[model samples]
Target: MTTTPAAPVATDDVRLSAREAAERHLRALVGRDDARLREDQWAAIEALAVDHRRALVVQRTGWGKSAVYFVATKLLREAGAGPTVIVSPLLALMRNQIAAAERAGIRAVTINSTNIDQWQPIHDQIHAGEVDVLLVSPERLNNPGFRDEVLPRLAATCGLLVVDEAHCISDWGHDFRPDYRRLRTLLAELPSGIPVLATTATANARVTDDVAEQLGVHADGTSDAAVLVQRGTLDRESLRLGVVQMKTPEQRLAWLADHLAEQPGSGIVYCLTVAATQEVAGYLRDRGLEVAAYSGQTEADERHALEQALVDGRVKALIATSALGMGFDASLGFVINLGAPASPVAYYQQVGRAGRGTDEATVVLLPQIEDRDIWAYFASLGFPREEQVRETLAALAESDRALSTATLETRVELGRNRLESMLKVLDVDGAVQRVQGGWVATGRPWSYDAERYARVAEAREREQQAMLGYLRTTECRMRYLREQLDDPEATDCGRCDNCGGLTISASVSEAAVAEAGQRLSRPGVVLEPRRMWPTALSNLGLDLKGKISAGAEPGRTVARLTDLGHGQALRALFREDTPDGPVPPGLAQAVMDVMKDWSPEWTSRPDVIVVVESATRPTLVRDLADGLSRVMQVPVVGTWAIRDASVPPRAGQSNSAQRVAAVRRRGGLDADVPAGATVLLVDDQVATGWTLTVAATAIRAAGASAVLPLALAAQG
Candidate 1:
């Protein structure tokens, strides 16, 4: 039978003082009789528990920021207050916090995206006053049901509110999040004298002031004088930092293969992209080292198991992207960056994961020349243009009912991810509302903050330059990073390479380098055929919907442009300044090899070759098609031409609906195809696959039995 848990009883030790009670809770939390709170930790706890005031604590990792809140929760509950609500940022962090609360004898529960089924039961427990502490994600703050139903009551009844990773709350911070801005509304709803705590290890002077200002404001938009700011020096005594520069990516991989095991205990190897994580992990595994790849693409269950594996020292390192940045706690003995982060602030956050539980942790960076390109790609995804925002608002204003993101895709020119992000910002800004089905206009006046966005963009550019400065600086590495974070006590650490403490070897075995090069050079990526047409295509005057009737066969690409192997070559060949000509001999050779490997998987041989007309690189596309036809002994059939030669093809079209419409309006097969013949459809590159799909469909209508698509590169 199901039963609700009973509410926690207050501590019976009334004779003990508040400090004594906090000490007792601390000892219980750390499972050590000798455990005691630091001075700043006690100050933070006192501000919340004794003074009933808002506080922001900025301390280094492993400085016991969590102990203050957990201890404060114990004291507050003992004084007959309600449960403490913690707005945490990451799932991994939530799990760790819940476990820590359990250690302190506090009954904690969580509600996040991964636990939808348990939200109601958890809410029941909260209503029953059985939960002493409740953890929630920042995204949950604006959830329609929770915001309308649960949040108001939780705000009124909650005794304490904690915002962990508070750096994300400020736009000036390296990891700015739009959802976190909703905390202002929550704060405005909070009753006076309800103690609140904000904590982060990575807030600079600017971010610190921003967060403190937010915390000090009350329900009536008035500032309180009693807000406490407890900030400590940012330093890690256990970290020994160094930089190892290599001439090429292959040398870096080779060096890792040669020296990864020589580092301290289990750790992480950070990569700039998901593709790099996979490639690095595979290479390291092939070299007889136990490793696994972790990214946003990794499954939740698999990610949990991988975390466990790392904590248990089963894997030497987790080759990962920024997805593993926050809230993952382990006694990591080392951290190696395969490429530099865009800013020193972000770099400091990632490296903070290490040296938290142990002394003498090794930190290294292998700076790459390609880091700037990766940074630029991410920078492009920032806030949209003023015109785009206006277009979105106009569309919502014209709609009678709430429109889903898919429906908006037909009317707006933004991609799905970018569009959803903009709507969230709009919702938080009071210009729109996210309801049961979708979003609706709130009719509230909203203006584009052009100057603010421009400032943000300029700040990002400065941060990028600062990261580049870190690479070339000859000063103390640790101190350099600390200064970038605006640490007042930034000083030289005696353990970095510049300080003459340690020197990393730049040597790699020639054989290992050769092997690494060969592994990266071997390339063939399978492209799955598009099975279904994009939704609401009919709205664009295209008579297409549901599953495509005659789609192109599953195809092959020589490599993804994101690949570490053939990517460099393909990027050079596709540059705007590079003159269009015959395909490079080296790339042509690689394409032939890809065909050789893919031939065994084919259901039938191709009898004719058809090339997709390219306005940008026509010479390269035609030369590739003719070379393939001559080598494979297939007849050159015809060209797939753009029906309108006067109109230039649009570049950087955002969504699939727009891309499909554009392709169908201009795509046509200009050559005759033999009936019941297999046709090879070739293109220079495949981004959305709409052009190839349209061309293949046209060929099928022209009496071809089957169409096999091929591309030189795939854009991920």
Candidate 2:
């Protein structure tokens, strides 16, 4: 059952001490009559309300960080200060805070991506003194309309400002969100004497120092060295840690199937990738366990439902990616990682989700060898090369009017997602700004800090090495993690598997192993065709723009070489140094299995096979095409040849606009085709799918009735 707050106190009572008022507020917030404020909590509240000074609190999870802010909001509101303005990082965090505030009779409202329709109402509430607290996602601060219309008023009158998860303000934090850096601009614009509070649970000394420095600087660029800092122990006695090293994906899956039922209560099973989350969730359900998959791809409404399910114990677990991390408030009984995150700090943050409100909870790491490769893939997606940054700045500078991200994508070589990430970072760095329609070049002097970025990259490498060391360490697991966070008083915890010996059995029944093996070895994934050409492609001098005609049906990839089952084999075949060779017997066989398991959505087989010409992997592409042709007994049509051999392969490019241009410039399918004949277009791999799209479009326009795109393996 949920907690209910105590009755509201009479705000007009002159005799209520700050301490008395704070205790009352806490009682109301937690629905406890005897709730007492911790000494540090009281100190933070006094600093914000009485002294009106900035403070930083680095406390562990379930540490009542919210109470400090919520109680302070109530006290400040009763004193006739404007509503507290909170800069939060996640929607789940905002939702939890809003609920907690309601219990305390605090009228809290939020404005974020999922509530655009309610933003005006929320603004009115704040303006009319109806809101005791206002919460907003950091990304909202960068929205052109929000920044121009709402921020100035709030900054000028907000009684208190709270930066939750303040560690994100530092690039060194476990998760570096570029949008959070924009908080500096917000801080600079805040009215003088407004109390500011920054709270985080995951920062090491280095990150804390950086965040403190950023928080100390005021609007006029004056630095105050007197900012208060509160540091606390990260040690959680309720957490029992363990590591189960598994040799293969199947072994891990089999182990989970056999052991998950023995876990204490409903909890979270964290996966490193969205695909893995979905895969694990599916396998678990097949094993008759109630579970759900949650990721960024899940709709906002669905994510909320899944979160509620976990909280209410409706499901055994929510198989999730980092999207479900950070702001989730359930007192989960366990947290199991299928693949270890690259950093020990990040690992600590995720595992911290467990044992928060319970006496003890399981925290296990099922580390797999594939995790390193996965980490390397993601780490490579960080800040673009200097040339890409310059190209983006130049494109925006040339535009007189603001250019939308789609239009900018046409002008730059970066993919839309990568391009957007770069622009947001640049926006915070003051090199550019997102304005009314899209983005504009700020024309501010900006230098590419190659040194800083390199340092960050190096830091990431060190973190990865530390995590690997964590797997092998026989010392206290909790101590190893605390030391990674640079905890000053790190010590051995008698709770982990290392300290007490393995409490979890690593054994799995052979039948379970066989089932897991079958599940992992499964191949084939549907490739949903691009519905619309990227926005503003015409501006880049490319005639191709707008919706992709529907005749080029969605295709199939034999496997996402990233899959837990067949991924290892596929990775070996696609390795950089591996010579271009003919399709191997094993991979060729996997393709046959994929054909057998083709989705019902793809109802037709090809009448003619078409190969996408490859300059670098010609032998591999042709051999795969020939192999497929022999298997399906389909006629081999002429290949799509490159118009110019001098154009570089589109292997390294990350953006869709450039990939399309490169593929189109090399124009394929020169000859006309028979009408009404189905064509199976093949490629060695599909990264961005532009190559497949361009080839398929050429085939369809050349009078083929239908086109089915096929590839040996799809890039993860």
Candidate 3:
């Protein structure tokens, strides 16, 4: 069958053709007659074709950011100035590059503490200006003896310097490294105007900016264009995002066994803990589901072998962590997020691993309600505090022996990246020793535990505020999320708690569709004046007395977050049990009375409307929506929409507020809606009711003869 090629997508950004990129690399590696290249490798090659003196390659993990630099190194190498130097983060990646080079008949070498002996010749060749390229880690560069010897020797003849996994430059990076900052100076010491190329497949816009800024590059030359450099959206159109709501880990395991037996594909099941990873992998393997486990604790060779097994069909399913996805390709059909993914970034990166090289794929996000509070507490910690770094440094200096990050977590209360950052900074100062296997302190002492602990805790509080802001912002969740990551399609999950809690899910009947409208309910969870259950109950008794309803919303209950709740309450409310948890004493009555007696601005249809403003990271919104839905389960209409009021609109209408009002004339609004579907207005609550009145009217004129409004609250 003859097929027509798709029209080039008309994006403002320039895209590189794989053929052009490969041809350029082939010419550069002219002497290597056996260089085999894939389309992805060529695309990366073209992306690395730099006009600017310094370049950064941020492609998808498997999109070959290394090849881009490797090919560029090949070009720069044959130019015959001096040997090129590569600073990589991992020993495994360096080994991968060396192996590929050897296979291609080109010379390459790596220098990490584990393989320091093999690097002796590489150091001599670099000093003598005879080697083609040398790869080393940043920790090695900061070595006092190596600083006086290997780096200075190579800097004299080095033509190009490449730093791989450049996202580590970001303070927000999953793996931040302070050692990276010092490498910026090595180029200035080099003679040939050694242009640096930093590369990664994972940096978001913020990380990208940090990387360029840290490298001291103006970054104006870096295209503002987003290449489809990250893995393609793997929410496969052909694969359904199946969901299994479970209470305990065991139930999930049982569910997986049965489900895979019914519809199996080379698959992956992810767990947040190493113990869980082993448990799941072992359990599945024992149960006769070909399985393997991958975690940070797994040996590099073992992890790589598991990845290969997934691809080669040696294992039909692998239970692993984020370690499996960064740069492996598996033509698998399924992935299951066995727990609430930590963040949208982490989730995207992990789920992206599935469906690669396949025509289609599927992902299942299995949720545990118990995970919510932990996630909330987690989101509360957004960024690492400077004080935390300072404190960590002091502790490391004081300690005589080296310690692993995991060990410090127990000895100290450090957030994930906070611990990684301090260790990275210590490595830069040469005050810490990165042993053959782990990290340890080198100096006599700096500061003890108490003072540093307070500083880090205080800093964490500040970061928690920022993370709370992201979760609670009163703007279009899509635009808000984009502002955070500068990427597209983040707000797509239809099942997030946020999406489920939307006005549509709670709005009143179709008969009252024209009367109600949607809005954001404020001061949620911890950040605002939270309407706690006990407090509301006590207050209602003290204040409203007879106004509250005793028995209502049949077979429904809610667990509300007060300004504060002890672990005992949290566990009782969230831990899987009997369906939905109970709201703090009187809060349930408050929500019920509010939904039943509270009037939405408009009227005609359903009793409530649920509107999930954002879907990117749906945990918060979904929780509110689902909670409200369960309470007002009596057939409410749900509306899925995004409200980005911040981006100034076209012509006179500057934002969503005025534009949505103007929409009253057209089919109500522009994106897309069923022509005759009724419009039931929804919002978290109505303070003055202006937003509801406006939204309801607009949707009414759009089609619905009536509009109904509903919310979590209503004012006097």
**Global fold similarity of model 1 (TM-score):** 0.96
In the range 1-716, model 1's lDDT, one tens digit per residue, is 22222223325353248889899999999999998888778888877887788899999988888899999999999999999999998888988899999998999999999989999999999999999999999899888999999999999999999999999988889998888988988987898778899999998888999999888776665777667888899989999889999998799999999999998999999999998999999999999999999999999889989988998999999999999978888899999999999999999999998998897898999988778878988898888899889988998899999988887888887888889888989998899988988899999999999999899899999999999888889999899999988898999999989998878899999988998999888978888888888888877888888998886898999888777889878877887899999999889999999999988887789999999999999999999999999999998888888887665575326788888877877768887799988899999999888888888888989988888999999876
Model 1 CA lDDT for position 181: 87
Per-residue lDDT tens digits for candidate 3, residues 100-157, read 6664445787777777577767667666656667888877776667776767877776
Candidates in order, TM-scores: namely 0.96, 0.96, 0.52
Write the candidate numbers in order of decreasing lDDT.
1, 2, 3
Whole-structure CA lDDT of model 3? 0.51
Off by over 4 Å in 1: 1-16, 645-652
Off by over 4 Å in 2: 1-16, 599-604, 670-672
Q: Residue 229 in candidate 3 has what lDDT?
A: 34
Backbone clash pairs in model 2 (N, Cα, C under 3 Å; residues 3+ apart or in different chains), count: 2
Q: Candidate 2 clashing pairs?
A: 414-655, 415-655
Cα lDDT listed for each candidate: 0.89, 0.86, 0.51
TM-score of 2: 0.96
Indicate whether candidate 2 or candidate 3 has the larger lDDT.
Answer: 2
Tens-place lDDT per residue, model 2, 253-338, is 99889999888898999998888988999999999999999998999999999999999999999999989888789988999999
